[model samples]
Target: MNRPIAVVTGASAGIGEATARALAAEGFHVVLGARRLDLLKGIAAEVDGTAIELDVTSASSVAAFLDAVPKAKVLVNNAGGARGMASVADADEDHWRWMWETNVLGTLRLTKGLLPKLIDSGDGHVVTVTSIAAFEAYDNGSGYTSAKHAQSALHRTLRGELLGQPVRVTEVLPGMVETDFSVNRFDGDTTRAAAVYQGVVPLTADDVADVIAFAVTRPSHVNLDRIELKPRAQASASRVHRG
Candidate 1:
């Protein structure tokens, strides 16, 4: 209760869930946010954190969530996910729009809402969970890659804009992370999701969470701009050493 606050979006699953648990262990009074209040409550209870029903796409929801938490030193933007695997020519525009709204605007909403609290702490940190898709363009990954790329730009621009402020921005880009991400991306096709990681040792939510925690826990004088991580089975967005 005495430690500074750290808020995490999409805290019900995957990297967000892991980040909440890991941040709690790092002495932060973690606040869990997501549309699924039930799931958030479970993780919040386990980590001794606060849970709120936060739909980042809604301005009112984000405002309400922030108004409840007055003090935040860290904010982890992890609310977005990939939607489909169709190439550009066959891609669905709806999916593309959804990705952009969630990944770009959602993060923007929370960051803008919580900036005051974070700055007040005098050691604010914003860690965005982007992906290798942010940097690499692959066939069938155009929409996702576009969204992530925009998200990456947001992180970079924030870093520049907040240079004189107390906040530091960091982007955690992971490759081939084995999470519900694949399943969700494939629209609940469990078999297809399983196949993505079948023959390769992909990174886990815990692994990325570990990196996130490390970046924010550094000496107050040091700011880690970004951290790019991947499993040994992956080389790039298109290169995977599948055995």
Candidate 2:
């Protein structure tokens, strides 16, 4: 029998990368997808997996990646990030569009494109990484929060749609993860990014990755629908224990 295959998007860094590693260690043949070919190559070498260039915003790119991995049993939709810290009143329309393009449309396109492949696998599973912002909006979360809401909605709908099928859909909503997410979102403002988790134990990429691994590694009969994880210091999306 062929080994189970897993496809992970945004596998170049953070939770995505960590999840890929964990899955690979668990003996799944992982396919790493991301725009950074170099980073993907490095990860693939380390994990003994295949690497595919994937730009989630581009339909052609998404299609190409899916075509390349036609027998994926597990799909991890993890390519997304916030653009700016702007309130709804003054938020840039372009930023909102970009966020939606990546967080919503990207996920939809990839999931839809790979649905047939997943269904064919007989034991397929989808694990999407959402955020606490999906449920609780913050002050400057106009664009990102809205996009995450859409992502979570997709996961929920997929769970319902695949209820009768053998496929399983899981959504993971994590809070205040200590990753390069904030740094990239803030355009490399390291100080600001560090301040976001100052004096508080934040969730690590491995933490979320472990949850994702657990979700996918369940028995064929068990389907984990939604998982919400937060740092002890984080009470909600708006409230975090700071120094």
Candidate 3:
């Protein structure tokens, strides 16, 4: 029997990297993808997986990545993040566009590109890492929230379209995960990024990765439609107990 292959995008760090590691530990041949080839290589080495440079926002990049690994038992759509945290009125259109292109369309491209291979895997899973913003809106969260909402919609529609198929679609929504998500959102502003998780116990990359691994590792007869993971200090998108 051959080990299954798992492809994880946005895998340079955080959730994507951790998922690759977890799946590899579970006997899967993991392939890590990200724009940061250097970072991906380090994580890939740690997990004993292959590293491929991938930019989900570009069709060509996605194609290249898919061509390298034409088949996969699992596709973890995790290549995305927020650009900035600003109110709706003062929102930067560029930030909004980046959010949409990276979060929504990025996930869309990979899911569509890999659907056939996933179906052919016999027991396949498409797991998306959305955010708590998908469930609720918050002040200064318009840009990220909009993109996440679209992503949430995409998953729901994919599920409907793929019903009765061999592939399982699962959306994992995480609340306040402490990772490069905030740093990238703040554009390398370590001070600001540090504040987001200060005085609070937010979810970690491993936490989300563990949940995703559990979902995909379940029996073929089981399919986890949607799951939300949050820390006790976080009740909602904006209600973070920073104490």
For 9-122, candidate 3 gives per-residue lDDT tens digits of: 999899998888889989998999999999989888887789999988799998998899968999999999998889988999999988999999999889988999999998
Off by over 4 Å in 1: none
TM-scores, all candidates, are 0.98, 0.98, 0.97
lDDT of 1: 0.92
lDDT of 1 by residue, 97-120 (tens): 899989999999999888989999
Model 3 Cα displacement at 13 (Å)? 0.3
On the 0 to 100 scale, the lDDT of residue 57 in model 3 is 79
For model 3, give the 10-residue run with minimal summed lDDT.
234-243
lDDT of 2 by residue, 38-150 (tens): 99999999999999999999999988887788698999999999988988789899889889999999999989988888999998998899999989888888799989998
Q: Rate the local accuracy (lDDT) of all candidates.
A: 0.92, 0.91, 0.90
Candidate ranking (lDDT, best to worst): 1, 2, 3
Task: After superposing candidate 2 on the true structure, give the runs of residues whose Cα lies further than 4 Å from its correct spot.
Answer: none
* Worst window of 10 by summed lDDT in candidate 1: 233-242
Query: Rank order by TM-score, top first?
Result: 1, 2, 3
Clashes of each: 0, 0, 0
